[model samples]
Target: MPPLLRLVQQQGVIMSERKEGQSIEEIYADAVHWHVNTGGETIHAKRMGGRFRSLKWWTGSLWLLFFLSPYARWEGHQAILFDIPHRQFHFFSLTIWPQDIWMLSLVLILLAMTLFGVTAVAGRVWCGYFCFQTVWTDWFTWLEDKIEGNPIQRRKLDAAPWDARKIRLKLFKHSLWLLIAILTGVTFAGYFTDIYRLWVDYLTLQAPLVAWVVLAAFIFGTYVFAGFMREQVCFWLCPYARIQGVMVDKDTILPTYDAKRGEPRGKSRGGDEARGDCVDCKLCVAVCPTGVDIREGMQEGCITCGMCIDACDSVMEKVGRPKGLIRYMSEKEMLGERLPPLYRRPRVIVYSAIFLLSVSGILYGLTHIPPVELSVVHERQPLFMQMSDGSIQNKYTFKAVNKTPEDLRLRLSVSGVPGLQLLAADGDTVTLKSGKTIPFHVFLRARRTQLKQANTPVRFRLQGIDKPEISLEYESVFIGPSKA
Candidate 1:
């Protein structure tokens, strides 16, 4: 090493001197070489079974619902179909039409606020466990580990010339990854159409162009991203990672290295009075998916997965010392200060307020979505038509959209002016098909004397014939000649 660079490194770091243990010399030798990932090489992270590892597995498993939900049957139909062609989103018995799409804004807000709140409280827990990128990458790496052997072996294999065995393993691993990608694509398309029928269409080569396009795109993206990019996606591609710094504060809990406790570092074998607890094994670095050295202070690459904590704890255990060389702690706690309550944090308070408001809006929208919608347009060409009986008549275009799953037979009624009558709607009912909008003409007639003014306020109502409780209304105007 250059004397200048070594001096610079030693100036800040507490260096170890003269220590015992079989791995002590090796630790000191490798400690000076540990560096962060710079997106230059594929990080071959070692897999270790631990509590946080198990937690990651469980969180990743939540995505199973994305694959399985389209198969669920409700009232003999796909339970969670988007039905884009019909412009309706079906969720079990609930159907959301285009008019109700405003609720999606609130739903999006709720999700965003949830992510912000969680990030503010416990740094990047979503990115570590729940994010699709992290989850898919985890699965992809697991398959790679099983097929390519441990990290050291894998690195050796990469350097070695590929022959028959290496070729076989690479092909097998890639095939499995491609299969997963294809399944992910199919699952995504299933949400827009019937899952069983979609599969049949694909097998029979009868699927639509849009479905094929979506499937192909998802397949390619999943394969390349999860199989190759891995943590680079989090480091460079994800916009949330860039903004997460703004949401997080000193109070946020993160996987932190206790520098004060572990510095002045040396070997763990003897009670060396000149050194602290850290042995500098670099096992924490080896096991890191993102190759972040936690000892360098919190960097953008840390996903707060606590894998370092698990690794450091294991190392401490092996050295016959108390654990928590690295742990989940706020900066305040790390500095031996009192950790503030959640409500005391301004960011948490703001995020919680937004979250609660968005949730309230979503709930209100869900409960208040009407089963039917109505619109009425008065004729524009001829304002009013004179009837043979000398009663002024006005023509109107009435349109009704049925949002319910069942066909509706509704009785039409008009009200507002005294002696007003429905010239065409007397004892008449309109039959509306499920999820269909239909328009028809209606005529309203009244005496010239009953008009009272140039224009009169008119109201139209559609009451369900069988279910009287379900009704829709529209307010319109009666156009007539101006009063003298």
Candidate 2:
């Protein structure tokens, strides 16, 4: 049987067995009273010390590179730079020009494929750990925690009347939040320009107008979204949240509540005699960043950060019950079905295939990038000039682009017809400016008697004098008098 079909069958069996113990009316009654989190009230989630919480902190810290990358130096230049004016992307030893923009497309494709593949296997790991919104929100809340104390204290402060102490605390927290926001803005702007120079410019009040506008926008965005808006940004602003439904399947693992084990709902006393594992403490909701009650079933608000699982496990430990009352599990697994291996899943297989294909294409494009690009345009007006010496002369304009950083002297030569000579303003050598296309007129003269056909194919070769390895070739037609 197909994996999906088998999973459906197993789910049917589990549902039937669970329902046999209780009537449909009873199940409906239980579900109707379940805790559902809407964005109506302020959720003051309790902070806890746990394994997943620590993992979240470590993973979220990776964003620090964004603030520091602009300061990195390589070969007396920014280590990684996107020089938009010059149409070049410099990465240490490698310099990519507009001619290599196809690689950028491949890179984007690879990233998208990776995200899709991971989403198919595990739901929203990117949003939970690596998303800028989540990371910044974490930082902002951590600062809030430091200034205002725990969740209860924060709630109290929020409800408290405007006193001198409240004013002072609020002012201090807002000031710090604004400072971090401004720093984030400045750091983002630094990526486009020199970080050290930008700091100097800001200090001297000599920065460009665009820089100031970008800084202000970033500061406002970060402060409002990370500090004030918080999970509301994820709930309403993020497009990924809307599209994630299509990427996930039944087998996708997510932080979930084991309803079967935790239902028939009774509170745990000092001993385990009277009820299911869940003590109805609501600690999961207390610790949720989005204030979602995992036991209520999956909802749009859950970031899958596993904070609820951590909170619930701590509660379970305290109440002398086994952990994982809430845990990471697939819908299929919860329904008592065997999950197919990751490679066997259709979505994973398809996404991985596309990911590999995109990677291969990018590698091929990079490896085969030509050092220099050349083109020759045959002058349309008077294609051939009959010289006094009975030679059929052709006027050709040579355009050679020196893509490298240094100016180069190139030697041009034409081949195909016998008894052909090149007449230029100079010898075979011509000077080309670095990163510029140089257009020059060249005369290709051949004895009419030596011409075999009216339009004979010829090839032009341009070789750099400084580096023989840097060369390009173009094929053109060598014109002659029509056969009578």
Candidate 3:
């Protein structure tokens, strides 16, 4: 059976256990009422102060880099630019051409491995902490809470008639949302163009149509998705939530409710012996961004944000009970089983191996990016032309792309074919234009007696005249008449 199915079965048996001789059915007779929210109404999740809340704020602040990085300068150029028109990706001093695009595959693999490894260790921490949608939605809602009111007051205001006060608050909130959305779009586009000029063009309303389109799309998406959709986007729109079920196992640590200690829950009426630690406050559900109940077991709506843990811990403190009714724990730990180390888990081992390999490949590619890319194409229409001197002559084209900022003075030579002679540009030096691919035609002649076969192996070597450290080679065939 699939691991996911087996995990579900094990959790089901755990949840079905009897408490203090009471039957499984009797234990759930007073279970907390829970229902799935299907977008009928907006969930105004109450915010509170806690360790995880502080961690969320710290993680969300990382997005400030996205807005600020485009303005960074390097070597009199925009640093970390994806210059699509020039077909080059510039990262500080390194320039990547189309030929080195294979590095992108390694980058993607590295990201995938990281995601899988993190998911195997902990559940959906990326979604809760670092996802753009989560962070933006948090910002939008925090603004709403400050401008409108707390969750209760906000809900009441939504139901109340539209007054002048209501209109003013709504307008101010949406205007701020639109401003953030516009900045996000513009900053993203700035990575491809000059940000200083882009800002000027946007302010003057002289930006290009593509820029305007990008700005408009981001404005709509950010305003609607972050401001209105909120957790519904994570529940219904984000594909990651759906696939995360397979990534988690019994050992994965997640925000879990300690049902064994918290069952038979009731309001504390001065040392009620029959009741468990739970006070039945329902504060956990109120603070949950996705409106999920921790006692109801893990659900697809859970992003594992740990807001419920904070709420439950705070409530336990108020009632003079021990904290941690809900906390980060694995099913194995909850079931009184020994938790295995990360290295012992097969899933973690495989993901780590792939992650390291991708990192190694990416490092190799970055360190070995060539200063010049060379290609030699032998003319194949006539294969070879016979000279009046009964010599075999071959025509070839040399295409060299100089990736450097300045022009290169390069010298070309031929080898591999015996008695080969290069008759190009009077056998003088060649100039390669900076950051451009230029083609040069050349002729190669070898005595017919020197040619051993119809296709003779040849190597074209290009060495930089000004920088003697630069050397590049291309292998091709010197076509000639077949020897009988």
Higher-TM-score candidate of 2 and 3 = 3
What lDDT is reached at residue 375 by model 3? 84
Residue 75 lDDT in candidate 3:
96
Candidate 3 clash pair list: none
Off by over 4 Å in 1: 1-36, 425-427
lDDT of 3 by residue, 1-484 (tens): 4332333344442344445776544444433245678888899999998888888999999999999988999999988799998899998888999999999999999998899999999999999999999999999999999999999999998998999999999999999999999888899889989999999999999999998998888889988999989888998899888888889888899998776677667777456686678788989999999889877677778888888888899998998878998999998987889879999999999999999999999999999989998888889787899999999999998888999999999888889877899999747588988888979999999999988888889998888899989999899999888787
List, residue by residue over 145-248, the lDDT tens digit for candidate 1: 99999999899888889899899999999999999999999999999999999999999999999999999999999998899988988988999999998887
Model 1 C-alpha lDDT versus the unseen true structure: 0.85
Query: Which 10-residue span in candidate 3 carries the lowest summed lDDT?
Result: 4-13
Looking at candidate 2, the ten consecutive residues that score lowest on lDDT are: 4-13
Query: TM-score for every candidate vs. truth?
Result: 0.91, 0.90, 0.93
After superposing candidate 3 on the true structure, give the runs of residues whose Cα lies further than 4 Å from its correct spot: 1-33, 425-427
Best by TM-score: 3
Q: What value does the lDDT take at residue 472 in candidate 2?
A: 80
lDDT of 2 at 378: 97
What would the TM-score be for candidate 2 when compared with the true structure?
0.90
lDDT of 2 by residue, 216-248 (tens): 999999999998888888988899998997899
> Could you tell which candidate, 1 or 3, scores higher by TM-score?
3
Candidate no. 3 TM-score: 0.93
